[model samples]
Target: MRTNGDLNNTSAAREVARIDIDAAHSYRSLAISEAEDDATIRKSYRPFLLSPEITSTDWISKLELSTVVKLAEEDLHKTGERLKVLVLYGSLRERSYSRLLAFEASRILFRLGCDVRVFDPTGLPMKDDVQHNQPKVQELRDLGRLERRPCLGLCRATWESHCRLQKPNRLDPPLRRLRRPTQGRTLAIAQVSGGSQSFNAVNSLRLLGRWMRMFVIPNQSSVPMAYTQFTDERLADPVEGGSRMIPSGNRMRIVDCMEEFVKYTILMRPHFALFGDRCSEREERVEKERKATEKARKEAEEKRVE
Candidate 1:
């Protein structure tokens, strides 16, 4: 008794019901999977401790420490001196991923017994507009002179082939004046990308470090889709089933990079003074001075003969 239109309506209703049922089943599966992940995490809970001699772990809460590295008596620095690290970020955003990453790095470096200093670039002026007496500029330059190791955290913007200009690039003009005097100092680079993982920013930072006469460390970190990687101001642990398929899943990469940086700094600190002692450059300067002296002597002799 039903027309063709009524048949079509009945079929559409059945299709809608089927879709609803499937959606409910998908939601239930997702919930169960999340619960399993949580349970696994609880069962495998471990603290992340870098040094075995750590007596107090009151400062560590979020970072899960499992590995304990014990240094031999000969391997330890006899001076008991701590490595000084300077951390700089390129962004000024309130919720800047670069800043967050820098903070995370500072935490790791501190736990490793390094004196970490995070430079705030707020109120810093551009290179052209900067004055020598400016407080922020002086602070940055002082830190540059004092700290032997620098770690840069850069923010990658949306652009084709390259990222946009960053605020920290302004630091080059002042630091460049140091020239070869600051050569052989260690540098570490880290970057955060808003979209996918990209090294454009870190690559650019490497070039900058080279220009500044710093030795950029071999290990670098480029975090992808930074927004999802952080939870409650801390990097989310993405390790499930003891695997880190996602590049930015584990913060251990950053920890490893920092460890390498500290090692490099220790290795090169004793040889820093030797970097500026280039025999060739010094000889060239001496030759120029000798030529100038000879020319002046010739001029004086001609005047006496006349």
Candidate 2:
């Protein structure tokens, strides 16, 4: 959560730096809560100077156990290596609940024989900050390039004049040019702190993924009152649930979503897309040429009639 200053310096005023404003649409900070916050507040920040310890649970619920077994049955084509995944989280608070959830998901994924990597969003300038080839950007790109052709991130979504993911994010299109790393890859979303359990952010991501030609998986997860959903090391059990229950409420949704992602990846492996979006771009060019040719024919026909 320490976006600007050293984690050791807890008292420093090293808050997030000046954000580059997006010119297309003007934003005004309306309701900045000393106690509550929203995405519109471009500079809204919380100080989480400590890293959270992700707890592991060996006790699997019957629901989770059954889901895993069913997934295994569907994964007859186990490609022999752990599936690789990349997780991105939004917010810089040292104890970002979303980060905790992402980490918890990573632990579960790792236990499920996944080769997982979680990106620290620190120094990740907004997509509008610079070109897509910037060091941090390239690192993200490369991660999506290798053996694992999918990129998944934990993101904070917002609702303003309309619905969209958090501003100044990595998925900005102008910076990426033609080589979109997410193109032809698998994607899924998990949101946190949806006071109303809104899936707006994930829905926006789904649209953007399709625009980039990504094979975004249909399943996604969103946690309402996300804080109530986790503890120091793992997801929290329902506050009102019976005794001896697992501390995982909405956490199972994450499992369900990821399980679906794995199965779809295997099922679509052979006919997977080629990255860089060249194929889509090529289609656009062909469409334009067809229109132009039709116009020429129409003009010729008009001349002959005259």
Candidate 3:
């Protein structure tokens, strides 16, 4: 039952006895005897010994099995339960129509039982080396690294943000990290347009989301003549120059679409819940196996010596 590493080393027998001994006195005596009789052996089998290079087919097979075991343990620990959504807005205008649209969308989602976070692009540095290490940028990076739930970003189409073309092979670090797909999280994009130009913005946002591997929802809103649509209070007044107002029918359509989008976002993907039971069970199993295997190998070696 001796393990391969221990088979060639005679001193491993006493070392194994020291490990397996239960009685305090017996353990003390064996430990002292081994330490006195085998200083070199103990040094060779130090606590920080490097694992042998795995080369044999059997070793490779065992490694693969261990990997599978690790993955299974990880999967069992993963629970599908809660969802987190992050919203990213591309516009930073003083009275940005896009930001207003984002806020409205957030409200809709909040009412529908989704945890929503919004990122303001105002202080976000342009994709460059100088700003990469900035604290705010790092914060953005950390948000993207969230392991438990997937984040969703909402960007508006504007000349300053969405409509502009990104350089080839040049990626913003935050965007790059956020785009990685996880088990339970999803990304959604919506484009808010000022007027008929929203059609173009919707297309731009779709392309942006697609490039990032986010699930692009076709349900997009383009507030034609968006400036006239909002009142000083930021509510949809939809009336401009004290003359024309967006038809109540069109306003209702926008509201309804927003509601549907919120619903679809929550129901779209299952959230990954943390599984404590599976994690504990797997840990216990690994420990039990390690102890048992070590015990059996030690006992077999002791019997051979006797």
What would the per-residue lDDT of candidate 2 be over residues 64-162, giving only the tens digit for each residue? 434443443344335543455666666677566667666555555544444456665676676564455667676656655634444432222222113
Model 1 residue pairs with clashes: 47-64, 47-65, 47-66, 48-64, 48-65, 48-66, 49-65
Rank candidates by TM-score, best first.
Answer: 1, 2, 3
lDDT leaderboard ranking:
1, 2, 3
Q: Each model's TM-score?
A: 0.62, 0.57, 0.49
RMSD of each: 18.1, 20.0, 29.0
How many clashing pairs per prediction, in order? Answer: 7, 10, 8
TM for candidate 3 is 0.49
Candidate 1 displacement at residue 251 in angstroms: 1.6
Per-residue lDDT value at 107 in model 2: 50
- Between candidates 1 and 3, the TM-score winner: 1
Best by lDDT: 1
How would you encode candidate 1's per-residue C-alpha lDDT over 1-306 as one tens digit per residue?
765568556655644432122322221100012233344322322112123222133223223332211221112346455566677776778777677667667656555555556666777777864497788788767766734434222211211124643565555666666555457778888887777778887787788778877888898887777776665434433322111222344466776676577667766766667766789999999999999999999999999999
lDDT of 2 at 255: 69
With a 3 Å backbone cut-off (N, CA, C), the pairs that clash in candidate 2 are: 1-92, 1-93, 1-94, 48-94, 55-233, 88-153, 88-154, 235-247, 236-247, 237-247
